[model samples]
Target: MTFPTPSSLVFRQLFESESSTFTYLIADRTHPNEAVLIDPVDSTVERDAKLIKELGLGLKFGLNTHCHADHITGTNLLRAKFPSMKSAISENAGSKADVLLKDNQTIEVGQFVLECRATPGHTDGCMSFLLKDQQQNPLAVFTGDALLIRGCGRTDFQQGSAASLYNSVHTRLFSLPDNVSVYPAHDYRGFTSSTIGEEKVHNPRLSKSADEFKTIMDNLNLPKPKLIDVAVPANINCGVH
Candidate 1:
């Protein structure tokens, strides 16, 4: 396939079928060979690596949106392959990431810079990565589990608070331009993307008032993730024993 213009970005949305996880690969077309992977799954490392090689891109960083409860991250494995490539996660996550990303901290990928936005609540350290064009216009926001297409992440566990999640979404994500694309970490349905405007009005759980949102979240009574017992601990140590 042809690449994008030098001033643009090369973007790919990869998936891990088992966990319904979405991993994003983003690179600056000006330096097409340098890239970053977000929310990578341990089971998909080989596939991700092969795809990176085929695209002639060097994996420069492995970033986790948060400490996931469903699957272990591929950060350590990617770092093993590319020692210089950093591993990053939100400081609140308490993961052993090479870089503890804070709100507004910038990460470089070729000529593209990813700005971290603190979007906790689904998890204490959840983050959303925002990318802007040279004109400083909104491009896309990688909303981990914090913000989904028509729904939001479950706030029943992992130090989650529905009130905090509601506040974060409104103040941090909904405040963005209406057109900014939203790429979430996982989607149970077949949806590929959504826009901030869509979620603002359509998100069943979070679009409601904070009090209503909390009531809904509190009553979800959802079952815990099947892998939480194993995944949580492994993820804390970057998936290493």
Candidate 2:
């Protein structure tokens, strides 16, 4: 099916200050009331819902790119407000997902399709969502902590493996067209977006050999996320806590 028009797409980038997480909202402007949200935070549920309502958009889906450890998800709360809204995550994430997405699965929105590509590394079930045009042209990729502007998610916990992450970024993401925009789940530097070409040549971590990448990931003894204890459990249950 062909999309209404490029201008008929409603895309919003929302952020949560505490976790520096980016939540995206995509809807067809032709049907202004139907929308999908990605990587929503528990604390921002009311804020997100208010914006959706203010825009006269009805929530259709609450999707998590993966199980998060830094902050809780708002999928349950969103479903409470919009009973018809479904929650989804990667099938291997081992969480409660109304929809357990498989690799390469396509999520049908109004007139667009979100292609799910498993990019496990930051976590065993990390997935990226590729938003494509009706003609199947590449638009952008919502790379959950898997690939960032110039950095990436920590590969020291939650079944993280630097080798897996390197392979995912190289084969799954870098293979895309150079112009494809990359929208990561978090960015502490406040920068917004990047492209596949830029990341391939400039991403300090992934630009190097796989062996070096693994070495870097192994040596970085980063501290655990402040909310890991609370957030992980809450996120495991869809942020009901």
RMSD of each: 2.3, 2.7
Task: Give lDDT tens digits, candidate 2, residues 1-241.
Answer: 1223377788889999999999999998776656999999989999999999998899888999999999999999999999999999999898887889999999876787899999999999999999987778888889999999999999999999999999999999999998888989999998888999999999999999999999999999999999999988888788878
- In candidate 2, which residue pairs get closer than 3 Å at backbone N, Cα or C atoms, i.e. clash? 33-58
Q: Which candidate number has the best lDDT? A: 2
Per-candidate TM equals 0.95, 0.96
- Provide backbone clash counts, one per model: 0, 1
Model 1 lDDT, residue 55, Cα: 80
Worst 10 residues of 2 by lDDT: 1-10
Give lDDT per model, in order. 0.88, 0.90
Reference-based TM-score, model 1:
0.95
User: Model 1, 1-241: lDDT tens per residue?
Assistant: 1222234678889989999999999987678656999999999999998888788788778999999999999998888777777888999998888889999998877767788999989999999998766656668899999999999999988999888888899999999988888999999999989999989999998789899988998898999899999999999998775
